[model samples]
Target: MSTNTVAGVRPAAEPTASQGAAAAFRGAVAAEWTKLFSVPSTWWTMLAGLVVMAASALQLAIYAANDNTNDDPLDDRGIVTVGSVVIDSVELTQYAVLALGLLAITAEFTSGTIRTTLQCTPARGRVLLAKAVVAGAVTFALGLLLGGVGALVARPTLGGWGSAPAAGTIGDIVAVATYLALVGVLALGLGAALRSAVLTITVLFAILMIVPLSLMEPDIAVLNRIADVFPGVAGGHFMAGDTEPYPGAVGLLLLAGWAGAALLLGRAALRRRDA
Candidate 1:
């Protein structure tokens, strides 16, 4: 150790292992955020998702209003609440967020930039974690935006006949945001594991929509149970506060479990595979 005699001079100490790891994680997160926002697709996807949400919400609201005005209102259609409208819009337009998450990680692989990324950050797990964080955060914000816009667009029309319970509507919005964030994490995990944007998107869509739809029949108990646990169904249950099969919290937990499982698989694949 050299003792510096210069005024206000001191030798800098090396960062501890934990501190180094934290710094590396922070760097990775910053890099991922930069990479995600630097592209035009992110903005375009968000805009498209917003448009779809607004359109869906407006249409639903108008229909509800029109039905209420008629003498022979459809009793089969349950009360059209703000929460339902927002959640329904989100359900219809979640593909944009999923696409965002898939592209966040797979773009690197597709463009051969993942090799450079791995070279720069040798700890593959940290890179994946960072990507998950970035994708989750962006999708969460997008969810909030979409939910808020849908509510605003629907309020004028819905006020004529639909109900807008403050607590329920706010809960639904927050739940949608949480669901979208976790869904993004799931997509990130798949993207990391597969390293192909197209394949990951297709597989994610199937898992979220197609499989669940195929198993939605109530007559098949086993299939219904399996479908209820899927991410899309679980998210719907949580956001809508459904009590059937299980409580809303259980649905959130199931969705979270799915995301966690995907992340573990992604981490394992990332560590074992060559960049």
Candidate 2:
């Protein structure tokens, strides 16, 4: 045991494995956050997404208002389904979050910053995990803002069509935000594994939209059952927040499972593949 003299106390004890891992994760998060904010594309994408959401919401509200005869207020029959009117908007705009997630990781590779990033965090899994956290957080925040504002703006018109959600407006809005976060994180994991922007985005799109639709054949019960587990389908069901093919709890769990498995796969690929 080497001990320092000259009025110097013994060196600080080394951290345990768990402590070391926690510290590393924190550092990785800070680094990834810096990288994420430095990019101009993120700002552009978020701006574009918000613009689309606002436009669509206004259009829906206007259409609803015009449809009424002699300015009679609409009932709660059509406007309120599966929770809040905002939920429909939240679910429809899910693709934006998925794209944001893919870009969070794939952009690094596209810009050749991935090498530098891996060098900073040699533990590839830590890098992927940090990206997931950052991306998921960003999507959640965006979801809240979009869903809350869109819902509020359109609520009066939508209210005529249906009653307020039993779950409360705030709860439904927050649930949509959480669902966006989960979907975003899953896309981040797929980005890490694919390491290509185009491929990751296409695959995510297919999983979220095309696959389930294509598999829906009136005669094929088994195909529909298989589609039930896809992260997008499961998450979409949850967003409906009402009667669904799968229970709400099961839908959430399935979405979580997809994100976790994809993250693990990404970690494995990051470790094994050349940067």
Top candidate (TM-score): 1
Best by lDDT: 1
TM-score per model over all chains: 0.92, 0.86
- Give per-residue CA lDDT, model 2, range 34-123, as digits (tens): 877787877877777677666666666666545653444554223443234566665457776678888888888888889998888888
lDDT of 1 by residue, 1-275 (tens): 34563566786778999999999999999999998989999889888889889999998888877776766656435467887888888777888778888898788888989999999999998999999888888899888888888888888877756778888888788899999999999998998899898899899889999999999755598999989989999988989889998999999999999888999999999899887
Full-model lDDT for every candidate: 0.87, 0.78
- Pick out the ten consecutive residues of candidate 1 with the lowest summed lDDT: 70-79
Steric clash pairs (candidate 2)? 74-160, 75-160, 75-161, 76-161, 76-162, 77-161, 79-161
lDDT of 2 at 74: 50
Candidate 1 clashing pairs, residues 3+ apart or interchain: none
Q: Clash totals for all models, in order?
A: 0, 7
